[model samples]
Target: MSHPALAFSEAEYRVRISRAREQLVARGMDALLCFAQESHYYLTGYDGGGYVFFQCLVLTAEEKPLTLLCRRPDVSQARDTSLIDEIRIWLNAEDTDPANQLRGILSDLGFAGGRVGIELDTYGLTGKNHAAIQAAMDGFCTLVDGSDIVSSLRLVKSETELDYIRKAAALADDAYDSALDTARAGVVDAEVTAAIMTTTLRGGGDVSPAGPLVNSGSRAIYGRGVGGPRPLDAQDLLILEYAGTFRRYNCCIERSISIGGPTEAQRKLHGLVRETLEEMQTAFRPGDTLGTVDDIHRRRLDAAGHAEHRFAACGYSLGATYRPSWMDVPPMIYSGNPLVLEPGMVFFPHVMVGDPETRLAMGLGNTVLVTETGCEVMSRHSLDLPVR
Candidate 1:
């Protein structure tokens, strides 16, 4: 990378290459076809919209320098970012039938009859291009989910990755707090979302060009959007679930505040969730595994008679993104992935308990890092309800 401080350099690139070879060897596979954007960036540091042209890479077990197949424009960018040596260009227009281009590139790379690993979920062309690629690969290559092999390596962060996450968490909290202050009644959810987005940009953060969460009230409770009235009302609880992104890394901080004092029920749930969070943080120390910590959260919920009011996945991984990207916890809190918490990994434990019976939901969260001894939390927000 051009920036000495931010981007990976030649040495780091070699490390990635070594790890790729190791993964291929361990997986008992000889070759791989990676199309996932994150995977692409991880391997090569080439971050462009491959979906536009079906650009992708092929890695061989023979430890050959990686090969990239994409529209002509991406060659230089790829060279700067990825560890690959051969970057092949498609003669066809980027928006045209890219699958044909993919076939040509693959055949030229001698990947004709082998089991080719492909990132199914992340790689693709638009409908037109995808159809063409699908037709071309019909009888040629065997595509499988090669994610596990790569993910096993990516989950462990280096010191550099940790710094980015820490910065991202701070930036997210700053934006989240601003949205909390502006979440008075009569405010639109979109407005709150916009504020967070603007704050990230203004704070010298890389926001990934998209806003985080904007759900108000119940909308905030759902993982996606909270469809409701456009404007909020006094005494209404505006729940905000959002974060700031830095260079594709992201964090999730779920907080809710009342425009005014809370109702009796609201206060109770708020107290419960807040207390839960406090107890959780208070009790957790470094060296706690994912399963152990996840269990503790649930145990407290059970003791409080909230066994059923919890989020499906109460905790998630953190970095320049969320969802599929950040959902990689080793203890399998959500999916039972069983990853040990090393010193560098980070997780945001967010516990949200929703009681539709009272139409009141309360949430508590913190951003934590796994250190050699235990965990260190960087979040300053508390479980108490936020106010203007």
Candidate 2:
């Protein structure tokens, strides 16, 4: 059978595994139960969505091989993609209790009564599964929340990871250009979404983990993408928030376009929105807290009389994230967040404003990388509001 290519070098995976083990030691953890797909991919080049099931990668602090507990469907997935060799498969029988099987794996690994770190703050660990895991491991081992362990390590980009993000940025730029070219009066919003996704894949990018959020008409004033697509009006507002993903690494960009020509209010609001993002860009520097940047966003938009129209948080960190979201949190750009800016960190801060009273919206944003000098806006696209 043909095997798939891994995203990073094995040496890189080794370094990541060593670092994770070191974190476990420092935290007084004897083992780490990695449930997030990002954790598996980061540590062992494993990239399967079998995490939707009860899958876990057991990594002990001692120098030993990693063990994966998963369903049979992912047995080949693990063997082909990851360095993990000790694979235990739980059957799909009606009485199959993978949580109990996991407890058995922990017992075999000599983790009984040991403090193990579990990645609970992830989609992989569902409430039901977590409860089951707790019941199964009762009195066997102590499980602590270690959600931040792998995420903290992933915050700063490695040289190779930065290369992938740069490529993703180019694809995002092309996606915006494609959306601008395809969006027009009477065009279906879904069609425009298709153009954006097509541009990404055509440019050798993976499908975005979250949205190419295409909100049109009054929906442009909203933050999320709706399920049904609507036709663009002769004169309407369309918000296109999208990402260019390569090897699961993402760089997101958002823009609000005037479908026909803008009203004076829209044109002026867009300028302020763009200016707000520019000011936020200047503030994204090393040693500055994320709260400072958000304070600037809030203060600027509020001074312009759009306080109620703006989002609570401006943006968030971006990386190799999975479904249901692309905005890597724990360092969200919100008021009072104390996460310090650092070089090699990437962020997406959208200056969004929507006037529900006037039914108008204006937004501009891009993915940026923190640099030694300051921050570098990653997109080649202009922040200027596009007029279709």
How far is each candidate from the true structure, as Cα RMSD in Å?
Answer: 3.6, 1.4
What pairs collide in candidate 2?
none
Model 1 stretches astray by more than 4 angstroms: 1-6, 72-84, 91-97, 121-142, 208-210, 218-220, 227-229, 279-289, 321-332, 335-337
Candidate 2 per-residue lDDT, tens place, 60-91, comes to 89888799999888988788988885999988
How many clashes in candidate 1?
18
Superposed Cα deviation of residue 381, candidate 2 (Å): 1.0
The number of the candidate with the highest lDDT is 2
**lDDT for predicted candidate 2 compared with the true structure:** 0.89
